[model samples]
Target: MARATLIGFSAVAMWALLALLTDASGSMPPFELSAICFAIGTCVGLAARIFSPPPPVRERIPPQVWLIGIAGLFGYHFFYFTALRNAPAVEASLIAYLWPLLIVLGSALMPGEKLAWNHVAGALLGLAGTVLIVTKGGGLAFDARYGFGYAMAGVCALLWSSYSLLSRRFPEVPTTVVTWFCAATSLLSLVCHLALEETVWPEGAVQWLAVLGLGLMPVGAAFYAWDIGVKRGNIQILGAASYAAPLLSTLVLIAAGFAEPSWRILAACVLITGGAVLAAKSMLFGRDAKASAGAGA
Candidate 1:
């Protein structure tokens, strides 16, 4: 479980590069870019399959698993892009990032899971840090005009959190199944691109390389790692730690000269790091700590 949770953190680390890579990929339409990157992501999974083939039982994965997998990947992205289009980026993103907190809260419903005080506190602290990062300590004034977009962002949060939780219920399902989900998402994204967006391909070698980088990291292997983590890892810790993505992303942007440094970013780093440590207190200490925590609860 610890190893799987660490693998999940790798996904968050890869996601930190998403903003930098997308910025470098030029002004391609969202769906078009999604299609292309996910196509490469599909190829990535295929290459892995060639190296280590999954068992025959994995081939007989249930239909509901496929449905949930595709819906989670494609549905979350589609709504997220739509929300960004319809609302202010800062507001939309802040709302969408509630998935981690939602996951922490929702985990109580999972079988044999305990909703501890530290878990909730850690999640809330992470959310506070995320808010600082997303809003840059500025006030949010949500206008009535963007209500639909705000609602879409809420849906994005629910979809992703539910997806992560639901994945836990199907521990028998292999992570390799994510490959098919990526393939289906790529195809669906292509269809959406054709219908709703003008064709605008990546321009130069740099842009092309950026696109490939996105596919190989954030969009590709990240999902695979996440699948394994959510199915068999310490989900509460994963939920709290997920907030580190935005902080890491902001730092990456600053390092790449795409964003300016701010005191808020520094503060967010402290809060997020502290929250992760607090959430993982049991794992860091020992099973005796966990027993004590459970007794207190």
Candidate 2:
């Protein structure tokens, strides 16, 4: 199979896992959910690092590599959470998902990338789909508070894109180290969760299960697959493929019965899928040329 196809499927799988975890979190305290995700993720990362045969050391990574990742991970959670706090879910989601557009803009600053008119149109179409997802069936009537939230999410989106770009700087360092940093950063989140979200322990086995699931999937595994995809495939193609995350997430939500199978949702999925295909087809079609291969855990 083509490398791009594999990357695309794994990326979409991560989004589905995220959506499934959200449904799982319903019975759990948010803290437990957050804690277990980070904690187990840390463990999983450590295990992977210990057992895997090392590749040629990319370079002697300095402490600054970790420091940057730690900071970036903190910003990712901080901005996302604060955005949710400052605005409604719908508006916040719309703005937060704009990270790819931020990527498009940031490409000029990065090496070997350019933003073309096709990129802009693809981004706009994805944004329109996001608006539909965020508003649900309500359409685009947004309040000032929600607008503020969207702006905050916009900030978070840029921060994330910056992090994604910066990730290239730490090539040889195990992804687990960064995941560990992210886990620790959630200490700050843990404190906030205590103060604002209330309660500490998960209520029951069901909640515990939810927490475990989040940790294993999004926190532990998805990123590992993504890192591999970066190494083995085209970065530009993978970046474009990320637009599918939101679309696949919607499908997961529908399967969980949180959302109906509506026409708008269907249409949004079509637009996103088609755009992703356009954006990624080159990497996909030339399978022999860029045959990326990875084992998804």
Candidate 3:
């Protein structure tokens, strides 16, 4: 439970940093930014290896691991940025938080974990919370931008689900290898963004600072820390804890002046927090922290 709490906070902090950085870099394309972060992360990973790398991170991996995971990762980052860049943060975040709910069905259908009624109930609560945010604490109609943000977020979630289900096949692989894959897939995203969208480099120091933050904090430092937490803890703990990220990021946005404080955001936070708590309770009953902590293996 404590580990989950820590991971949740950590995820929130990372997302908050990510939101601030992106907002800082005005009109910086997501894929190009992704390429920057990935490129920087690759360098960091390489340097770590040179200094004190983990032993070679390969084993007998199924061919499908690379094929499925690579494609899904590529799609997830691409769509995630598109949604963030095109829509409002609060809107995009609420939509993206649907991932935890999606994971229930994901576990049942694709990964073969049964989806229970409690899961449905929790998801509904979370959904309601998001609706509250959209309405600004009451009732608001969905607009095109909001609708598109959700659609993009949905795609991101689906891709993430695919990646999650497939990651079971590559348990022994090293973090550096995973980082490499992220960098590799991100290159495709960069190409796609350049082809489909306006690509621009940061012109001034502010934009450059944003880019640096994306690479160092969001992509490099935070991701590396997340990997450390996951490796040290359980996937259930990591996943459940991660549901708190949206709430944390929203607060960060408000603080950074990128988003205004509103009841809707607060409502969504409560809903996400409460629902995640319920899910955590279920996991607690099923498995102890020490037990679940080893779930990654």
Candidate order by decreasing TM-score: 1, 2, 3
Error of 1 at 276 (Å): 0.8
Ten residues in sequence with the least summed lDDT for candidate 3:
229-238
Candidate 1 backbone collisions, by pair: none
Among these predictions, the greatest TM-score belongs to 1
lDDT against the true structure, each candidate = 0.92, 0.66, 0.63
Task: List, residue by residue over 1-297, the lDDT tens digit for candidate 1.
Answer: 777888888999999999999999999999999999999999989999889965865456888898899999999999999999999999999999999999999999999888888988998899999999998899998999999999999999999999999999999988888889999999999999999999998998999999999999999999999998888778999999999999999999999898998899989999999999988888778675565444334
Scored by lDDT, model 3 comes in at 0.63
| Pick by TM-score: 2 or 3, better one | 2
Of 1 and 2, the candidate ranking higher by lDDT: 1
Report the Cα lDDT for candidate 2.
Answer: 0.66
lDDT of 2 by residue, 1-297 (tens): 245337535854775668667666664444545665777777777788789786666556677766666666666667777788778777677778878767655665666555555555565666666667668758554687576667778878877777666765555666556566757766755776777775656567876676777777776676666655544444554565577777777788788787678888887887776666666554445453354333221
The candidate maximizing lDDT is 1
* Candidate achieving higher TM-score, 1 or 2: 1
- The CA lDDT at 249 in model 1 is 97
